[model samples]
Target: MTAPLAPPGLHTTSLDLGGRTALVTGAAGGIGRACALRLAGAGAKVRAVDRDAEGLAALADRARGLAGTVEPHVLDLTDLDAAELAAAGTDVLVNNAGLQLVRPVEEFPPDVFHTVLTVMVEAPFRLIRGALPHMYGQGWGRIVNVSSVHGLRASAFKSAYVTAKHGLEGLSKTVALEGAPHGVTSNCVAPAYVRTPLVEQQLTDQARAHGIPEERVLSEVLLTDSAVKRLIEPEEVAEAVAYLCAPQASFMTGTSLVLDGGWTAH
Candidate 1:
C-alpha cells in the first residue's frame, strides 16, 4: 500500500542512531545472525534472541567486534511473554525465526504444522503487538519480517511452510497499514533458498526420502527452481534488511522485496 508522496530526498534522512535499541529474533544463526550483525554495524544496540544458547553466545561475541553491543537472550519465541520482553524498547524488530517441514498436505502431522505456524505466523504478530506501542510513541520504527519466496508462490511437499509464510506476508501488510501513521514501517523480505544449517538439514532429509545423494538435491530440487541456479547468500539477504531499515526506506513500507533469483519470473 502506497502512502501520499513526501518531498524528494525525504527517505534519506538518517536516524544518527548510535544507541538505539533493536531486537532480532532467531538471531543465533543463518539470516537472523546476519540481520543482527548488519544492524549492529549500523550503530544499533542489539538484543539477539534465539533458543540456541551456544549459538546465541557465538553471535554475541561476533557483535562485540562491531560498534554496537549485543546481548543474547536464550528463550523460545512461542512464549508470548518472553517474546514481549525480548522486543521491548526496540526501534527495529526482525522476525526471522522459522522452520520448514516438507510433506504432502495429506501426510503432514498436525502437531508439526501447528509448531510451524506458531513460530512463523503467530509469534511475529505477538512481537509486533508488543513492539508497536514503543515504536508509535517514539514516532519512528522499522519492522522487518523475513518471509520466503514460498510466501508468494508454492511448491510440492511444503504445504505448511508455504501456508505459514503466506500468512506472515498478510500479517506484515496489516502491520504496515496500522503502523504507517505513527512513523513506523513494516515490510517483508522474501528470499529464495539460502545455504544454512536449516537448508543442509533439508537437503539430507530430501536425499533420504528420494533415494538420491544429498549433493544432487541442490541441482535437482533447490536450484532447479531458480533462474540464477545458485543459492541466495546470507549477506545478500542481510543487505536487503539493512536497506529496509535505512533512513532512505522510511517511505517504503508494506512491500515485499522478493529475492528469488527470478524463480517467480517464470
Candidate 2:
C-alpha cells in the first residue's frame, strides 16, 4: 500500500549542504549549538567554534549520528587574528557568538561594551573578510548573522547589546550588497528572547536592573512585549538559519528574517 502524503505546510524538502563546510561561532551551546547540528544534519561539515572546550566536545559527540560531521574548534572570538584565520575555507559562516550585559547607559561598563562589540561586530567582520575570498572564488557562499530583536528595537538596560546588534545588521546589509555579484547571500536572523543560556542569565540581570523579583521578570519584562507569551526555542531559530543557507533562499539577501513574536509590530 502507498503511504499517505504529507499534510499542507509540512516541510518535506530537506536542506542539503553536503560537501560544504560551515563555521558557527559560539557553538558550545544554545542557538549556535542548534544551528551547528542542523547544518550537520543537512550533511555539512560544521566547524563548531567556541571558547568552551568541553561544551564543544559534547556537541561533537552529540552530532556523531548526524549526516555530516561536527569538528570542534576552540577559539575565542576576542582573538581577532585567530578568529579570522578560523573562517578560512568555510563555505558557510554563522557569526553567533555574543555577550550581553544588562545595565543603564550611564552604568554600563566600558570594557564590557568593547568586549561585546569585539565578539558581535568586529569578529564577524573579520570572519566575513576571511571567508569572502573562497566564496567569491567559487561564486557561492552563505553568511548568517544571528542578531536579535534588540537590533531593530531598543530596550532599557541593554545598551551594549542593542548597539552591537545594530552594527551587525548594517554589516550584514553591506556584505549582501558586496557579495551579491559573487553569488553569496548575507542576512541576519533576528529572534527575540530565545530559550537559551544567554536569555536565562538575562532573567536575573533584568530583574536586578528593573528592580523586580526573578519570577516576575519573565512576565513583567521578558514576555511583556511578546504576543506569543513564550520564549522561542533555539531549534526554531536554527530552522531559520538553515533556510537561509539553503538554495531556496538564494534571492533572500540583505534582510533580517525576524522571529520576534510581534515584538517589532508595535
Question: Whose lDDT is greatest here?
Answer: 2
Cα-lDDT of candidate 2 = 0.93
* Winner by TM-score: 2
Poorest lDDT segment (10 consecutive residues) of candidate 2: 1-10
Q: What's the TM-score of each model vs. the native?
A: 0.92, 0.95
Give stretches of model 1 more than 4 Å off. 1-16, 208-211
Candidate 2 residue 222 Cα shift, in angstroms, is 0.7
- Candidate 2 shows a clash count of 0
* Per-residue lDDT of candidate 1, residues 140-225 (tens digit): 99999999999999888888899999999999999999999999999999999886677877977677666778878888888777
Q: Estimate every model's Cα lDDT from 0 to 1.
A: 0.85, 0.93
Q: Taking the tens digit of each residue's C-alpha lDDT, what string does model 2 give over 59-78?
A: 99999999999999999999
